[model samples]
Target: MRLALGVQYDGRPFRGWQSQREGGTVQDELERALSTFAQMPLKTVVAGRTDTGVHGLGQVVHLDTELERTEFSWVRGTNAFLPQAIAVQWARPMPEPFHARFSAFERTYFYVLHVSPVRSAMLAGQAGWVHTPLELDAMRQAAACLIGTHDFSAFRSSQCQAKTPLKHVHQIDIRQHGNFIHFRFRANAFLHHMVRNLMGCLIAVGRGRYPVEWLAEVLESRERRLAAPTFMPDGLYLAQVRYPEIFPVPAATLTSVPWSAVWSDPASSS
Candidate 1:
């Protein structure tokens, strides 16, 4: 049987989503927890691999298992064995053909910027803090240029393993609260460091270092060197993933819960 699992994590302590030789990783922790329950080796495939210090609110993974277990039990069982930094929020029995990595239609990421001079102890592992005030209006205007399909060579990381540079960006929204800024992006898929790179350029615009029109030129040039330095990984979050209809957000009454409250109130947030 195949099972789809929704996971949430604080990626600060772990090396990254993928396993590494010297340190703990999200994949390593998950596999270890499942092994104790199954009494057999269990491997899981994630929708996407997140870099170190990058968090996830709605990460999806698929695990193949022959043993039959109820969804309710599996959810509770997995969490019981998992560490506090990561949790198995939900698990559903998926079709045999449904794959976590290949079936995903789109992915969305969010970056939180507490753009204040003073550092936050509570948000130390969660958000990035900038010493200067950000121009929210300018950031919004600059973000608008990223909507639609484009060859995003300038934003991709030099180590990106994607075969092509073309990607379709569905939307980019910039919102602000006091000295905090939220940068959200949705796309069919993202190249390595693409969102962080875009945030760097947008931040540059917000600081009056670059004009909004310069983003168009950077996209056209497709030159990586032209973009500003990539933003911090602490602020990045894998906000959500779009699966075809199976995991779609049902049309139902929803409540307003702060993004920080998702893990605390699963029913209202999910």
Candidate 2:
């Protein structure tokens, strides 16, 4: 039987999501924990692989296992082996056809930026820092060009292994609450560093370093060099993944995250 697991992590301590020979990644730790619990090596397929310093609020993974256990047992048992930074949030027996990555229809990500001249010690690694003020209107106008289907080649990283650069960006919402700027991106799929690359450009426009039209030009140029440098991963979070109704994945969103109390989902419609 195939088992699906919901996971959440702080991500600061992990090398990244993917497993490596050094075994410092979130996947490596998770697999090791699962192996110990099952008394057999268990490999898992993730819905999305987040980079180092990028947190996971609603990440999903699936594993094929013959081990039968209650859902609560799976969750509590797995948590018993995991570090404080990571934990299995929920688990369910999945239909054989429910492949984690392939079955996902959409993904949502959020970036939290602390806008202050002097960084807050409390939010050090929890958020990205910007020393100056940004024009929210400018960022919104520039981000508007990203909505709809398009080839996001310019925003893709050179190391990205995705088969195609084309992606559908369903929605983007930029909001500012006091000293923080929150960016929400919902897309069919994101290329490696795509959101970070887009963030850099949008920030530039907000800072008046470039015009709103520049983002459109960069998109049309399809040249990675034309875009701003990729932003830091510390503030990035894999907020949610949407799958077909056949699965019993939870629908609760960004509201459940630790940061939600301060940086909740935007009130506007997508």
- Measured by TM-score, the strongest candidate is 2
Every candidate's lDDT:
0.82, 0.90
Q: What is the lDDT of candidate 1?
A: 0.82
> What lDDT tens digits, residue by residue, belong to model 1 across residues 1-270?
888888888889898899777649999998888888878999999998999999878888998999898888887888889899988877888878788878887888878888877898988878888889877888888877788999999999999998899999987867676677877788999999998899889889889999888888898899999999998899898878878886532221112215443223443223
lDDT of 2 by residue, 1-270 (tens): 999999999889999999999889999989989999989999999999999999999999999999999999999998999999998989999889998899999999989999999988888668898999999999899898999999999999999999999999999988788888988899999999999899999989989999989999999999999899998888999988989999988753556655676444345434
TM-scores vs. true structure, each candidate: 0.91, 0.96
Alpha-carbon error at 264 in model 1, in Å? 16
Question: Which regions of candidate 2 fall more than 4 Å away from where they truly are?
Answer: 252-258, 261-270
Clashing pairs in 1: none
